[model samples]
Target: MFATSSPPPSGPWAGAARTEPQPRAPLRTDLLDTLMRLHREGVAARETRRLVPDAIEHRDLIRWEQRAARELRSMFDEVGWPGLDVVGEVGAEAAWWCVLLCDRLTAFQRDAHGLLQDAGERQAAPARHLAYLDDRLLMHHGEPQQFGTQHQLFADGCVEPYPVDNPALVAERRRSIGLPPTACRTAALRLLSLTRGPPLDDHR
Candidate 1:
């Protein structure tokens, strides 16, 4: 992801960067299925959170994400960024889901961002993915997001962007990345923590 490599697969900051890994010659169906499975689990968890927030505890999600982060870290060791060439379009999208939901692994997620950016440059991955990741990283850091992908959910069922950088350029930035105009996706979640007040947790 970075110049040559990013975090080691063992841990987020366990060791120094190893030499950059290359995509395997043949397609990696194993990794594809693995990533897709992780994506499905994440989707199911989020869906449950949407339907019954109480049923899905924050710790439950964290536990699942720890496993997911480890899986993606191993995949990163196998194929740098899981680009389309390595895992095909569907698998690549699935892989992105893993990266996105691993909020607990901020360092790992941050390292993976560089890999995604490299994949975007090679045209093997979608720029939109990079946009989402970048916004997420900024959100994690409590900084202004470049694109309006991250949001804050209010207790009143109102959603708003977490202060975007260059507000005037949001539309243009979204367009460049093949995203629609600053839409905060609420279909997957009508409202999280319906009873909570002002500082309600945001749906990632």
Candidate 2:
């Protein structure tokens, strides 16, 4: 099972306490709207899989996610990085989710994401998602320091692929980016696996 460095918070309200407030920034209405739409679709695709587990629905969701991913890649190509300045708060968050939902990310695209993540962190954009993506790419390449976001599935369930470097500081790293403790994230992933079932393959 997945485990984070911190102790799980107590009580039914524990989860709500972990929610990070979204940063507010001026929106470029058109771009923000586009990003928000993509975000909604991405979320809907996931929800569709959970609510109705039909193979056709799954394939359609995959295609939809892939299309969104490609569009995000194209956007990155035009603009070096979609930071808060370029996309505003909500737009930047949506852009990160679009990339995060991408099933297949190229080396070039991953590198671009890393750059965006770094820039976003520096600019005080919502960066927890970026960190998760960065750590995911690192794990995909068999490198270390994954921030505990990458996992492997087995007959039993999902497990973290590699030990996070400086385990003692995992919570600190997450906290620095306005993320909740690692325990919360790990628990959430476990809940997701239980509800949606493990990935068909170890794509994470």
Q: Pick by lDDT: which candidate is best?
A: 1
- Write the residue-wise lDDT of candidate 2 on 125-186 in tens digits: 44555666777556555577646655543334444445577778877776775556554344
Name the weakest run of 10 consecutive residues (lDDT summed) in model 1: 1-10
Positional deviation of residue 145's Cα in model 2 after best superposition, in angstroms: 4.2
- Report lDDT per candidate: 0.61, 0.54
Instruction: Report lDDT (Cα) of residue 136, candidate 1.
Output: 71
Which pairs clash in model 2?
Answer: none
RMSD vs true structure, all candidates: 10.6, 6.6
Clashes of each: 0, 0
The candidate that wins on TM-score is: 1
The local lDDT score (0 to 100) that residue 135 gets in candidate 2 is 70
